[model samples]
Target chain A: MSKVSFSEEASVEVVTESFADTPDPRLKHILTSLVEHLHAFVKDIEPTEAEWEQAIGFLTATGHLCDDTRQEFVLLSDVLGVSMLVDAINNRKSVAATDTTVLGPFHMVESPPRDLGANISLDGNGEPCVFAGQVRSSDGTPLAGARVDVWQANGAGYYDVQQPDVQPERNLRGLFETDERGRFWLRTVVPRYYPIPDDGPVGRLLTATKRHPNRPAHIHVIAEAPGHASLTTHVFVEGSPYLDSDTVFGVKESLIRPVTNVDDPARAEHYGIANPFRLIEFDIILDPVRP
Target chain B: MSKVSFSEEASVEVVTESFADTPDPRLKHILTSLVEHLHAFVKDIEPTEAEWEQAIGFLTATGHLCDDTRQEFVLLSDVLGVSMLVDAINNRKSVAATDTTVLGPFHMVESPPRDLGANISLDGNGEPCVFAGQVRSSDGTPLAGARVDVWQANGAGYYDVQQPDVQPERNLRGLFETDERGRFWLRTVVPRYYPIPDDGPVGRLLTATKRHPNRPAHIHVIAEAPGHASLTTHVFVEGSPYLDSDTVFGVKESLIRPVTNVDDPARAEHYGIANPFRLIEFDIILDPVRP
Candidate 1:
């Protein structure tokens, strides 16, 4: 009995009922709840008509802005701390292992391979230091030949991804294997802390929310061995200004460490650096994930 | 000592005694766990460099798309089924009441007020029908003076918001208060099913995923009374096409009903309609929210 001739607002009950055949019970359940909450949220907020149009326009632009290189939305999530929240609820690392942080939006490519003793810094201008670390199981047994992937921003806190033309592709990024004793050592510059890209809608959100976009100075590392839960972590500089307020909420106390300057001639000779250089040790422990 | 000056291809261990002074134990715990899972997910996904960049760009655009009225990202979440999942986990409705669905982005502004028996249609060329509904507590107690806000698409399957220049402001939308007997009535046309806006990144995602953007034809309704939880729901026409494939995933069986034509002169006299007219009824029951 279809009546298609008069003009008036139709009934909601009839309209809602007509879509009974949608597949996916999960989808149905989710959509129904979303409608309820979203409607409630709108009623609660009660924005003006103009404001509503502005929101729509903003979303339209957001869709238009997407492309192969930019991910403004994820950055927004990172800056707003939602990403961190999701990660926190999911990771739940055991005690004793070093904590982890945000992988950031820049780790988009494969790192170059290198030997255990090799240096990853292509630019020689920054301060030199030797970083030695052991990859061990949660019970302190070292795992030899563990693969360690590392990347960092330059002294100015810019990654190669951020400056593809200026910085050589994969600069300061490398993949290396651990030594027989489950130890790895390499030389690199002290990375400078940097702010996230502030050139998109996420930047606008940051400005609107009065939140900073800087992450503390840190080096990102991912350690892995077969059967072990891969550890994605960072080593934060002890005094970095943004440590307490990493825009992505990535900084953790267990991941922060101080870089000690050592003038020991023997240690300097062993690593082939001049006397009085920076030294820091980062030990990583990984739990066994069910195979 | 800092002894490593790595070349572009060399790998180095950067000692990090960082994160020594980070406060906020909760923050530290969260950041650490997030780092672990995020890195793991990335490694697991193993997206190509180009794919990774594209994802980043998609997220960036999603962020840019947010504003006051439209939430493209939320829509994205809806299409991806994340929004519904969140809704289901949070809103575990019982079997008696009408189910929920995704609240579309169009409900941005407050609806215009109308008398209980007033028509909300500005266009007189569409379907003619009378909609009657009752409001009650979840236990079926009548709720006198309850409010019912309603809106719908026009004969062309377009909302007033979608055709501002053609449709009068607030066309097909109305807010009505229930009578002393907790009953409300209105006159209007049955709206046809239509497609969601498909000119954005979310549209692109749908296209790439080979999904249609069509939503089942339906009317939107929200009923509220003091001391009772507000109910936002929709009414689907029984036989409307696209009921099985609403792009926004908003369909509940309890919401579907047929509007049958009636030739009773007495009812036509009461509603001031012609002898042959259409009618549909829906009784909404809302639970009480604890203070």
Candidate 2:
């Protein structure tokens, strides 16, 4: 056999050339860049076969840890901050619009529709708080009838999905529509900072890296209306521990809302909640769809 | 609430800082580099949320496809040329030692010990071939009693593990010891080029990239001795269709060996094979252990 020697550099070239015929141009571009970056990483690491095998095992375990209710890969991306980085790059916000955040793994459950001012906290376990918000276009026009889907963990920092047996179905989850003034309101409890689902491969990774797995207390919102780009964002609580160190890096200054103490009885009665409740005013501003 | 805004660059810093307490310095370095590279990849791609979700799903399916007999992660690394690159970076060859290649996924079955010149092709199928080899140090000194573990697929391009019902146990696999002259020989069938296990996600990746999945015909060998670094490599068939385009980027010119047709009846009789058998001569050279 004639010698057909290939150096390490040559092998990379061969692999890149092999993808020249990819049918889709976007796929071709992505695959080409992926091959280059992947090979570059391998070269930089110079991992032994044993080390390489360990990576394979880690990734496989990460995959196995995912199911219908849990997504370890997304968590992996979250902890690595890849999810937030992608969000930042793809969802560049207009100066007047709300900033975007991670649509965390727990958003799979469809939120139950509720009337304005409905209390999503069915069990009434956490500290009383009222959330009022407005949905508007970038130009300040009210986006009446816009759909605002919301969900959050209870005071103990457990989503209904995480504690299905303990929490009532759809606890702290509601879908409300904006009224004539593009305003919406709901009664719920102040969300507590909580650790992400650990005990899986992602948890193991956190432990290995000496990093905590807590995300700051926040309510997830996905608001949408016709003729506007949909918005998926989190309204993080100010002063929550981990606010500066969110494991998923989902915090944005524009997304933080202060929890104010509302001591007036009449004002509380007007919203049908007790006096001295915690009040948070958050507003969603959506960008018009590009032509 | 005070604003705690994070830009794309700031998020990377936050993620990197989360690993501040990593106990192992090497792990800290690896984790830091990984985070940087991963974040860079995401920023470069700017994949939309849907594209990101598709990646998560693809990885999940890849992990689910792994089992005891099959390893989809390793296959994924192989198809991406990562395995070979890792092999190359860590196994730089001495000027005189044999070039190393991938220890493919199929080396799971242990080779049964056999005397020199034993026939490993017990099934009595395919074109007969005689394989002879020498084990030596890079300085050309004979390595007596060196263990040479050898294995290959059948002429049908299926490993015994891939076809347990048909192929006899231990067929096409043997462990031979080098004699005083540092020579070892075995009789087996010529291995045919075969497609990798592509019914899984890795295969789907290959299809999406517009690449073929065939590996060139080759015999795997792992030669080990107490005083030298172990060598794991392949003796690929020259003129194989996939020689220039092995899916795993495992081919190297120095590893290819011509299969010569030996028409001499006497030689065939000497080796206890039929006339016009195939003969391949391969040798193993190991590097001295570094002090």
Candidate 3:
């Protein structure tokens, strides 16, 4: 019975009052916040009717472009930095833990399980490199048997799903188990920086805003171990374009790993690769699960 | 070159800087404000990744529901009161002028022009009523030759478009010009308060919130004159269910007109209606166009 007519000054209150009977308290909270912020945005923008219509059209177009393979709304969220913000908010671990970034849209397929030193580049795409990482607890104790899931775009910046005919199935994807010393190493092509699938409404937004659509070159990782929190993040390749200006705003200063050329035959042989192998090494630390 | 890593504390600045190169200043201003407000909302909600995904899915479903005849997003806008706020901001006139409301979605077809006092209820749906109103300027001068466009839902709370097979085309819709004395009258059925298209995601949202989707019974109006700004509004039928709880927040106290049972034979004869008819009289005043 809390029926109150709408007014400009009481807009937020009125709209929020409509949601008073939500069964879920959390849903009520989120809807209330959304209405308040949404109304505030509309009031601040004071959009003309034409402008408002244009926005609805934009969103509808964005939705229309989304399907199983293409997620235009996710792209919209990514380009607007909401995806990264959500990542940041959800992965708020201690400083001792490795920093996190967005798990981009390319992880649609699970990485096939492979031996620790197996090469994942089925088609030998991009520049060959050794991607070796150590998983550990926040206390630096090696987390043996930790799961390391990896996926990335090929040299030309396209994932297997994006180029079904051109790229071999799971061209640059793998799942691995860390050894007793908590180390995992495998062969992969150095991911090249590329524009997100931007031929759609989100791309139009980037173009309209004079923004670039390219994300920095990066490797995707989702690590998990018993008694430790699961972490989904990326290891950025240093010096890649758009590292600082990733279209998805997924770059973390600590997550950027340098691609170093190692002359050590011992290191290369250990990874079962040729001498003087190009290497990108990163280590991950996961926070212990709280009680 | 405003490349900066995304962080919770710097999310707003980093995102706004990305749109700094937008050529259109208005777009830039709007995007800047939008990003600021949007990021603030995300931060406030601190949605889990799952919650964020749910929102994206909701929007995608809302988009998928949109077609030539269905605008689920507009319904979303209306239910959240954004439509009314936009109308309020755009139609900020002096109190002497008429209060404005949302132009509901049924005004798709052009209302056919009819002479004053014509019967718009071709189907004879609902309870027969006489609707009369005068178009005047803010200074109280009758505005002759004002083009008044009118449309409304029928008794069962459905428009002709919703029931094409049952109702005739252009049923209960009309366009008439104000006479020299600024008087206009029409024969129509009293509109019944009805639910919005509640079979979609927005309807589910209302159901989830325990909010009924019915709007107060009302007739849509768009009056335009030579030197006055055109207005899109509604004259709400008083005593109708949901008048105070119009789901779209389109109700204004001044815009509510009672459907009086007037027993004036002479007046009814002048209007060519029954002696004892249901008369809903509403007057509209437009604001002059700014120089």
Candidate 4:
């Protein structure tokens, strides 16, 4: 045994050997690298004991602030832009196709499917509009029998899922399959701009950061065909107040379009609409994914 | 209203004009900056859709894996070095002062305090050693009555808290006060090197990064003197295998010291120790804090 002194190292062993066998060479390699990098970072910026403890405490609170209906952490991610980062990396759009945006935290497991040309608006108080759209490949080839899942906030920018008691079960939300020429149309009220859910830690974060939580008024669409990459994009009303500054950063330049007020009684009659009704037309172009 | 199109900035007005009110400037600024930078990062990487989804899933899992006893996210922060960065910004050490390190995930509240010269090693099985040290101001002035909280691993390098069921509470942990000459001495067992806890997301991250999780043997020490900056640092054992490559990068060359062995029977009688024993003597110098 070597002599033990409180002098600079030369005699005593500074580190101990491994206590247990670590299986999985891959895991071992990954863990070792992580430890080395992590350690290096910590050494670079030495923190006080109190500050370190405070950070731990903050993390503990963030964990406790999570539950079934309230995912403050997810909202945090959404605001932080990690959600979009992941979406962008996973769903790179073709040059000719519409760009994808964040799938906000409001999507639930199931939405009611409806027939094409059917009206999804339960309350008839907002601006009456007919939404007509086509699903096509990037090369303009129509995709027959494509499915479109669509949902949007009411005139007040609240969705059925958000105001379950106020809105009917399927209000402003429907799934429709395209016809032979990849055409899908529906009659509904135009969506309105509204604030995001603000009753949790995410709200506190917004308050702390001094950011508005309002998302632009837009229709959420998820279009899919068997061989093509599924498209989840949004169509913002060209005159929506929050377009330039969507709270969740879920807007694109290509998807913004005018809602025209048509006065021709004959055209209105063909679509079973009263004269001077509002109209919105959108086209979705998807790209085929490589197998 | 103007006949709005995708190119028209009119959409911005419509979206925000109808909302309750515009967000405060600070939040708006932070959110906008964050969005810009985050978007830039995404564009730079341009990861595939699947990879983006996987990144989202990783974040989701990171949030889910957090709880009272464990915070994988904080560990993530520690490993990422962000925690240290924040800490460093908050705690800038004065010149000649001991540097701080990561607080680690362990470190429960209220380590049972003990009187000066008390033995913290309860196991009684490891190689017996004496630890004697002094607390002084940077200019070598003794700091009498300074509080010193110390703890270390056992002969096998496991904290009592790590082996709760086997080791007695408060084993190898103690609190002491400096004497008039700023001197402190205690009898204890030599601590050994050990691995950090590796059963959480931090562990998974380590595995993914190919890094080892071993830490060199060291004693934790927190010294507090009136009107001076308190220090939370470690007295690293010299010659330890992991000293040069601490998993957390906590080892500083100035802090490493050898634990010497003594075999003088007469001297052992004077200190009431066995003929063959170990001795470790060191000093901790601290910088004064104005506040």
Candidate 5:
């Protein structure tokens, strides 16, 4: 074989040059930058052949782990914090609107529509919690008819998809709308912090990195209204164990809502929940669409 | 929900800190650097959510495309010039050994051992060629009995594995050993340049990038002997169309051997071949094993 004599510098140059003719300028720029960074990573690591092979095998396993029901790559991105970084870059809130986070892989299923104050936890498990919130614009004006889609793990820290036999379909998931006053409430069990699926490659990566796979207990919410930019975020339970180190980096200090123990029988009856149940109030603020 | 403002800088810090306790220091360093580069890549691209999703889908599809026989991820690496970069970084020759290139996915099957001058091209399909080479140490001493494993695509630019039904099993692959003088020769058809298996996600990426997926015609070789470091490389055919722009960037000027068209009938008869034949001489130089 001939010796082409490739230095680390030359390798990067060749790769970036290859993408010069990419028809899409944005794609070309992205690809060129990607080559530069990726090559830099290789040079920095200087991985042996065995290590490179191991990486290939790990990536292959990650891909195989995904099916119609699971998305391992997204989980990979989330665990590595790339997903949150992208989200942060793309959704720069202007201080008036609520901050956004990852739309975790679980949002694949569309929430089942229900009336306000509906019980989403159909299995009747875990401590009853009444979640009440109002949808408002950044200006403090209530946004009537805003759609709110919510989903959360059961008290056992498992979603309906994870325990199809034990959990009923659509358990702890619902789609609700703001009333004339932009107030909406739902009856459900308090969500517990849960481990992200870790039996696969991403899970292996977490374990290998000495990092816990648990996410802070949180309820995903996607609120959208005409004339407002849609908001996709999570309302984390205050004091959750993994809040400070949520495996997916989805937690935001502003997104944390304290759960209060409600002893008032009148309020419990009004919200159609048992006395001594937990109550969490989270208000959603959406930014108006740019004119 | 409380408002926890997250800047791009904070996201990287959180991720790097999460891996601080990784038991393996190398892994910890690799993960940290990976996070830094990956997050930087996302920030540089600022890809739309749809673009991000598209990338995830492409990666998932690449994985799905791999089975026991195919490796789409490796192909992805190759087309992105990552595979070559890894090869280049890991195999930094000190001017005493043959240059290394990618051990492409097709080297799965073991080469059948044969005597010197044995014909590897069983179908007798393309222009016959005599591949002769000498294995020597960097100090110019003959390295007798060095094992040379060689494989190449047939005349139609397809490997036996690629067309199992059409090509005979192991049609163009052989394992040979140098004689006492460290010389080995073989009778085989001259290989033609071929496009990579680009029907998968990687191929789609190449198309989108306006890059060709054709590799220069080359014979894969692995030469090993006692007291010397093993060599994994390719003997590229000079003047091959994609020599200057190998889709995988595996081509090296030193590895390109000019093919000589010999019309001498006497020489063909001596080598037990047709009158008109091509010839290429690629001398292997092995680096001595470090004490």
Candidate 6:
């Protein structure tokens, strides 16, 4: 006495059963759960034909906006909070490990390796600042020889990819290797808080929902030390707007750091920067490799 | 105090609350429920970064495949049974009224008006048959002057739109007014079951799930009479393949009708067809308009 007939009551079972013969069990589980939740959503919303059509149109427009440079679906997912959730789910960390945020869509090109004292503000877009960071193990031991990959927007809040014709090649992007003291230092411009690319359908979605399209100013960091877990996170400026309400929900309290006025002439000279320059110092803690 | 954080536990509330100031209450409600369900699905699946990217890629591909001629998203919805569920939810019928089904994506063009008893098989590609039907109210009273719009795939299982160059415009499609006796008749070929347009992402999904893309043979009908609720449904061919397992879940026991031989030469003369021809007879019942 099997119920093969598809009815509203039997919808979840019927669809899930259709995927029962899937060769990949993980895919099967994912799809089965997807259908279950999707049906629940449809039944709960009970959208009319017009509303359904509107949704389809919205998705199609979102899709049409995607290309090599702009990935609207990822932006859609980012705005919906799914992207951050996926980041959190994938990068579960130990108590002392740096909190991982979304890798974001801008890290398409690899960061060119540079020396510790090299200046990354190639276009000289914003006020010069020193970014000094130390990578350490969760148990408070310094992690020497750690590779640090960093990328960020310029003072105008546009990644290099967004304005290739205007910005210098690989502006505000560099990969640095930490020293014996687990320290890495680089000179770059302060990244300004800017709106996400808001000309697309996802941008229109934000407008329609009364949501802003801005992410707080921050530097993207990816720290990978040998025999330690890799991390992808951001160090937010102390008083950036939208810090409390990141459009992508990537902000965390521990990740915010202040920009200090370091007036030491010797240290500034050693770093090849002017005295009284603005500096952002952050310490990154990484966990041991997961079993 | 309210929680403004965006942890996994606080994700649904945080995202939904962002839409709190939406001008439309229905939009707010739908978005809140959507966020809730979507987050639940993501948590349940706990997909990895690569898997999430794969999902984003899949949706993007599906959206990219949509155009004026082909709507891959609609096909995705059809294969998932959301289309059928939406139909059932929208068209709750009286006990005597015919059950409703998906309007389907093929009815993009209007059915050209034709005289009753006209032959609708423009290409004469399949075995000739006469389709005779009566339109009646749910109380069993014949409803004269009813409008009947009908469309179907050809014997080769292709709609005119799917083969625009080969088939005539409005082939296998007609809109007719019932006679004084509430009788409508037309000559057409028997529809054949066919796979849904399966070259796109949705089709690839079917292949991954080990499910066929075929829908059973059926003719789409939309019946409307003055002061009555218009209905869209189908009369399915009896014993058709995939009837019990329609890719779109559109089959119902009450909709099935068998093709039978009509040996009477007199009736054939009246229908302008050969004697002892095959015939399919169906009757439609409509409900009074809902308040």
Top candidate, metric TM-score: 6
Error of 5 at A17 (Å): 1.7
lDDT of 5 by residue, A91-161 (tens): 88779899899999887678999999899998887778999999999999999999999999988999898
Better candidate number, 4 or 6, judged by TM-score: 6
Residue-pair clash count for candidate 3: 0
Runs with alpha carbons beyond 4 Å of true place in candidate 5 = A1-6, B1-6, B263-270, B274-276
- What docking grade applies to model 3? medium
> lDDT tens digits, residues A120-159, model 6?
9999999899999899999999989999999999999999
TM-score (C-alpha) between model 5 and the true structure: 0.95
Tens digit of per-residue lDDT, candidate 5, span B124-224: 77788999899999999999999999999998999999898899999999999999999988999889999999898988889998899899899999999
Report the TM-score measured on chain A for model 2.
Answer: 0.96
lDDT of 3 by residue, B122-225 (tens): 88879999999899999999999999999998988899999999999999999999999998899999999999999999999999999999988999999999
Would you list the rank order by DockQ, best first?
A: 3, 6, 2, 5, 4, 1
Which candidate wins on lDDT?
A: 3
Off by over 4 Å in 6: A1-3, B1-3
Q: Which wins on TM-score, candidate 1 or candidate 5?
A: 5
Best by DockQ: 3
Better model by DockQ: candidate 5 vs candidate 6: 6
Residue range A13-109, candidate 2, lDDT tens digits: 7677778888988777777777777887777777777788888999989988888998899999888888888888777879999999988988878
Winner on TM-score between 4 and 5 is 5
What are the RMSD figures for all models against the true structure?
Answer: 10.9, 2.0, 1.5, 7.0, 2.4, 1.4
Cα lDDT computed for each candidate against the true fold: 0.68, 0.87, 0.91, 0.68, 0.88, 0.90
Q: For chain B alone, what TM-score does every candidate structure achieve against the true structure?
A: 0.83, 0.95, 0.97, 0.80, 0.94, 0.98
TM-score on alpha carbons, each prediction: 0.57, 0.96, 0.97, 0.77, 0.95, 0.98
- Docking level for model 5: medium
DockQ-better candidate, 4 vs 6: 6
**Model 1, stretches more than 4 Å misplaced?**
A1-63, B1-192, B197-291
lDDT of 5 at B138: 91
Please provide, for model 4 over A1-291, each residue's C-alpha lDDT reduced to its tens digit, 9 standing for 90 to 100.
132211112111211112113466533443344334333333443444564565455545555566655566567666665565566566656798878877776677456888887888887647889888899999999999999998888887787877778888878888999999999988898888888777666666666665678877888889999899888878889888878766665666777888888898987776667888899889999998778
RMSD of 5: 2.4
What's the fnat for candidate 1, on a 0 to 1 scale?
A: 0.07
lDDT of model 4, residue A269: 77
Tens digit of per-residue lDDT, candidate 1, span B1-291: 122221111111111112223364433343344333343343344344344446656656665656664567767756644344333433455555555554567787689999877888888647888888888887778889889989889889888877778988888899999998899989888878987767777787666545788878788888889997666678988888866656665665667888898989998887767889988778888777767
